[model samples]
Target: MAVLTVNDLCKTFGAGTARSNRVLDHISFDVRGQTFVSVVGPSGCGKSTLLNIISGVETHTSGDVSVTSDEGRPARLGYVFQDPRLLPWRTVRKNMLYVQDKDDDQARRRVSTYLDMVGLGQHGDFFPGQLSGGMQQRVGIARAFAVEPDLLIMDEPFSHLDAITARGLRAQLQDIWAQSRKTVVFVTHDVVEAVELSDRIIVLQPGGRIFEDIPIDLPRPRRQSDPAVATLQAEVLARLEKMKAITPQAATAV
Candidate 1:
């Protein structure tokens, strides 16, 4: 079932001027439930633009963004941003429930379960400022899960964390996704991160073209040092580097 469909997406900045730039051009993709899809591309290749479009945070100049379930129902969305984006004054627990309307027991139960799942049960009352960067991102993850969204969109949520912390969180995220059975679209710049965390990796080029949509068939609990995973990582990064070299500068010009 297609949980999200993006058709003919295009985005341009500063149109009809010297500074104009065509960031994303005619991009399209779809994702199904319980699948983890990661996107990688060179810097300034419009990865964040695509994510913003999917979340309806940014409107495209052309194309359609649709989120429908397996049964064609409207899919509920949860987004975890790169910045964590938690309210500074609110404690972790309160921030998680900021979007909820009722004191319904079900909401409370869901929030509690997610907080524990993210290993923040004991730190629910901690402010965002009091937590480390990784812990703050965990709170962001917990907040997303608290809503029980059908599709979760994460934009490099662990990019700023230490290497060891990022590795641990990647595995934790996989476990959470497995247990929750939610479709996730993750955006990142790290080749190894994409390989270790995604079932399929979509490589975007300078013109917003998908150069590669490689499926990682390696078994679960994939390690960064594993031979097969390492090979895939190298291959993907090489492909990305090659694309950067081959993309015509004219295509990006407005």
Candidate 2:
């Protein structure tokens, strides 16, 4: 079943004014349950704006958007932004616990499970200020997964970190996603990262149009150094160059 549906969606900053800007143009896609879909485009292609609309932070100018839970209930969403956004005063465990609907044992167990998946189980009691930037991002990722959201929205979660750290987190994310298989809509400017993490990559054009919807059919637990992974990443970059409007960020380092 489709967890998220967007039909002919469009978002314009100033709908009626002369300085109108339409970020997303007739965008349409269906994210089925358990699928990892990535929206990869150059800067100013409305990647983040599309995410904001999907998460209800911004309203669409036209068309329809819907999110549905598998069990006929209200849909739940979890978000991981570029910044970790953890409270400095709270412990890692408490920071995660604060977002839960209940403080029961089941909730605690789920929090612990996701923390362990991100390799932060031992540091749960530590405050965010005590951890490094990478660890804090892990907490954010763990917190998002702990909620068991029907759809996970990630907006360039690794963009702030150094290249080495970003690569490590990508590997950990893939491992964790392998086990959880939560539906994810990840937005990134990196073709290499998109090819590594996504089951399908949705390339957006300069004016927020869907340029290409490509399926990634490689095996799980892929690494950046793997021959096949590198090959696919190169091929995707090659095709994106044909667009001519692909931003300089397309060659973002792996």
Candidate 3:
């Protein structure tokens, strides 16, 4: 049931050179099917670098990275970046349909379904320019879900949004994920958000090595307002702070 696996992963910039920088070193992890995993780390912990390597946007120096489909077919992927990255000229529906394998009734239905799930059913005809930042991000989320990727990669999708907007989107994301149950790998520096959204969290330390792999045992459909949820969030944040104190080289942002 392993959808994605990274074995002894290593990535270096200008390897073997005098000024070479080793970003990721001997990283390893496995993302099982239909589970939500979050990677949280300091500024230079190679969080995004690991994600890029998984998405094939960047190459790893040495490692095994594999994504497999259940039916023995090619594994498909979906990505939601910090920015919406929608075409300015394309309408909402058109933007969602852009990454689809083809234009067909099933695909059209999927687009409509996810748009409605993100509460943007009525804005299909609207251009990206017409929507607010939060709305555009919702469209991006919907587009990724519409594709129904085997593995979904999210890179701080709410990092650019205002606090209130980010909170609302986080809730929406939880609801959609509850129903779809897509395997997700989310990268963020926000410990509270990571605790709320992830079933298991992988903490990357200063050198791209895993500091901790914690499991979240809370109930689903979690909300920040919930007392139990808030308590766990506080605990996770405190642990990260302790990690920061121990490793003074790591940047603290929780």
Candidate 4:
């Protein structure tokens, strides 16, 4: 099992200056093993910055943040960004192999397993340019899971694709997560996507404060077409709308 904790987190750019900007202000949350948590908010609400802080790509101005495996070891992390971010010169399989800590037979097998999971098994020999945009993103997802991270972080991994392609990839992602049961923290602006894919949804208001924390009690393998899923998504969206109404700054930011 893996655990992630964020306490009293604060991030400010150009702190203590006339032009300073504070993106996150005293945000905190905890996520346990096998839980799928989504952080959804409007633009400039620090969604991506929060992910960056958790992934160590950026530092927080003040707070305590930690990720640890069950045995008290540092948790292993994998990330899937908005874009594929693949190396154009490398083959798909070689790109998968790039981030792996080992080059042994077992590592190769793991890479192959994840590739097949994303329906990219037969295309591993191809280069990035040889695959469609969606296929390349699939390769990125496979590479993230191939490392078998204790905590997986995705920053709107499907937001760059066409609606049809995004829908397909979302389904594929749900299937893979159901099987692997990896602890995931996903960032997205889409309420429908959050309702369908998350165990809990955290809504961040402007200035990086939490407006609401919602639990999605629905079952797994949910579809956007399902009546129950649609109902929940609508309810969540309405709640977000209410948040915007209450916060004048948030409404302007959105």
Q: What is the TM-score of each candidate against the true structure?
A: 0.90, 0.96, 0.98, 0.97
lDDT of 4: 0.92
Tens digit per residue, CA lDDT, model 4, 52-140: 99999999999988888886666799999999999999999999999999989998999999999999899989999999999999999
Using alpha carbons, what is the TM-score of model 2?
Answer: 0.96
The per-model lDDT (C-alpha) reads: 0.83, 0.93, 0.93, 0.92
lDDT of 2 by residue, 157-220 (tens): 9999999999999999999899999999999989999999999999987778998999999998
Comparing candidate 1 with candidate 2, which one achieves the higher TM-score? 2
Residue 14 of model 3, lDDT score: 97
46-129 per-residue lDDT for model 1 (tens digits) = 899999888888888988988876655566789898888999999888888885556588888888899899898989888999
Inter-residue clash pairs, candidate 4: none
Clashes of each: 0, 0, 0, 0
Winning model by lDDT: 3
Global local distance difference test of model 1:
0.83
> With candidate 2 superimposed using the best TM-score fit, by how many Å does residue 16's alpha carbon deviate from the native?
1.1
- The list of candidate 3 runs beyond 4 A from truth reads 251-254
Positional deviation of residue 208's Cα in model 1 after best superposition, in angstroms: 1.9
RMSD of 3: 1.0
Model 3: per-residue Cα lDDT over 1-254, one tens digit each: 89999999998899999979888889888999999999998888999999999999998899899989898888899999999999999999999999999999999999999999999999999999999999999999999999999999999999999999999999999999999999999999988899999999999988778988999989988999999999998888788888888778774444
After superposition, the stretches of candidate 4 with alpha carbons farther than 4 Å from their true spots are 252-254
lDDT for model 2 comes to 0.93
